[model samples]
Target chain A: MNNPADLRYATSHEWVRLEGEIATVGISDHAQEELTDVVFVELPAVGRAVDAGDPTAVVESVKAASDIYAPISGEVVEVNPEVEADPSLVNTDPYGKGWIFKLKVKDAAHVSKLMDAAAYAAQIS
Target chain B: MISEIKSSPLEAAHVVLGAKLVPFAGWNMPVQYTSIIDEHTAVRTACGIFDISHMGQFIASGPTAAAWLNGLLTNDIAKLGIGEGQYTLMLNEAGGVIDDLIAYRTGETEFFLVVNASMIDEDFAWMDARKNANVTLRNESAQWAGMAIQGPTAVEVFAKVFPDETLPPRNGIMTTAAGAVVCRTGYTGEDGFEFFSPAAEGIAWWDKFLAAGAKPCGLGARDSLRLEMGYPLNGNDLSPERTPVEAGLGFFCALEKGDFIGRETLARQKTDGPAVKLTALRYLDKGPPPRAHYPVVSADGTVLGELASGVLSPSLMTGIGMAYLPAEFSKIGTPLQIEVRGRLFSAEVVKKPFYKPAPSA
Candidate 1:
């Protein structure tokens, strides 16, 4: 249930860490915990353009599939192949190695509007 | 803003163990305790205990119970000796499956039926509509709590729990001294037994099994285990629109035995062949797991059918599912494509079971 204070999150449970013009995106720990076992992840291809609120990826558990929505509109700069190979990384370290994709921020200022760790924590609780 | 959902007798135990509860068929049931793969693996390698109390239970016993059941069910009830259980189907007049259940002959003229939770009300009404004076039908779901202890090590765990008792053979029910009926049956393709006891003692049994090393499994692991075995789930794999023949469960439908509710249509389908038969699909290439309602299509991309149930098999370490496919493309090794989130993944029609138990050393 750790929500790093530095990270910003979405109402849909995605978390983003922005540095300069790049934003690293993954689901929150609460999201991974709710999903239970992570068996497969379908990440957006690198360089794909995505809008905020758009489904950018899919995380599948043994029971069902869930869409991972983009927190901020941007072009995908890179994808995390590690979580793709072993989906449990998302469950084990959702805020770290489980980072799904990096977005080249189209509007870096828009990231500020998302909820902070405390706000996101309150939203889930 | 919300109405109440029924909880199992072991709901408190699930909460103590930190289970994730979800609404399933009008019941607040646990979907998982830990991860699904972890629980699923435990059932395959060791033993896992599941609270199946949401399923419905009914007692039908009287002067003409056996005869009435034979007409109401697809299986030949006359053949089932006392203590023996057989998987059977209740069907609509058109041969569509109402629900799949297991009927256990408990005495010379007494029977017990276990049916899907979602269909309990409808199933009861259907049976009652055909009821006559000679039989008594009672809905006993509230009085019992059911638990499935399943896996390779299930026998050992049962022995540890009931040290002095001998479990019934497969498909047999042994009434325990404590009034619990232990049935040598399970949904997972492994050796195990399902225990039905008075509702009040369910939590105690759940805790005792957990203390004895049985993993607390939820519906998530249950889905994956049964999917790997190609077992037809009531709502997902079998439905009022699907017949037993189309579900690849013709063996359970005793057509020649006598006329049942849906025998005419089933017999015709058996002779004419089902247009679309339930078949198993295994991923030929690794990708996102196929899920329910994902379209199954041909190489040319024409939609043939949709996946009835699909999951990433914890045992096979690959995606597996059951779907209705045209009889022409239902053979083993037939190449097929499953459309998952707008992408077609390579898959093939495989044998029913995507996993098999390891041979004993």
Candidate 2:
């Protein structure tokens, strides 16, 4: 509930924050709550091209496995090596330490249509 | 994941505490509230309570009820004293298991059976079709709620909550002041009780236990605990097409007893020898965790069997699973291979009760 205002969300529960030409991506609080207890996350290879709405990374919990879809089509500039070393960071602070990758957005205009804190909360409700 | 909402008696309470509700089988139940390891350890070292309300409860009673149950169950129910419970199996005519259950003999003419939630309707029909007027069978699952308080400190917690009367003393049934059917029986291979009460009263009793200081455990820990004990879940290890003969649960079947519903088939299988037996496997190399239906291969990577149940055991620190492998591979220390996520991982067939702690050792 840290006012997800600055972060933009996808219908699949991922969040993207634009920083200059780079966008930091990770799952939102609602997604982390639903996934629960992140055990192991398969990191995206740095410098890989990703398409939106497709599996870019995999996460395995004690219960089941899931895929994290790329919120926007992009080229992966860097992966969070810390998250691969400690996956629980996603469950602790999904917005910060849990960021999956930094993507160079292919279409910056699409970010405007994504939900903010208020709209994302409304969408989940 | 399909996240359609369904409510159990404690649905509101679980939502309030931010439980990760998942669709298990058919009901929406909490998979875990916090971490699976924390809850799993809580149930092993201390105490954890579970809302087993989704399981089915049944009653079959009358002058003929005992006789009917004798024919239906593999165990010798007639041998049980009043207030005693015995593990039993209901089988199809082909000796395939219909469901595995625990029957509590409330009296000579009264009995209570706890069965898998998913098979209640079919099992009830099977029992009813074979039932005679000397006995009566009724599905009481909807009217009752089953809750389990498990682990080493279970008795202490129960004693504090119900100080007025004796709770079941270690696998014994004892009436409690809480007006619940308290049985010291558990599936976790630990000291605990599975308590049953009217459905409406379950909510209050669940709250009462929590207020009295019991941790609410979820399905995640329950699966891990039972798996470690080599207890085959009904749907997984004991399927309708599989019999005690194939599942390595023949110990619960009494072949010498009087004729039962599936006695003939089971007897034939016993005489011929079980072609396959349930085997335990542990991964030798760290890899993707094995899951149900994953194939079990041989030393040279020949397919032997498929996994029946698999889980990441925090206690074992590896992927432990069960499979119905050929008799040759059922021995302890049988090195085998498990295909996890399409990759073969070196695994060994181990013995049951894999990690029995020193107290239960």
Estimate every model's Cα lDDT from 0 to 1: 0.91, 0.83
iRMS values in order, in angstroms?
1.1, 1.7
DockQ (0 to 1) for model 2: 0.44
- Model 1, position B25, has a per-residue lDDT of 93
In terms of lDDT, which candidate is strongest?
1
lDDT of 1 by residue, B203-250 (tens): 888888877779999998999999888999999999989899999999
lDDT of 2 by residue, B309-343 (tens): 98877677578899998888888898999986566
Q: Indicate the docking level reached by candidate 1.
A: high
| lDDT at B234, model 2 | 83
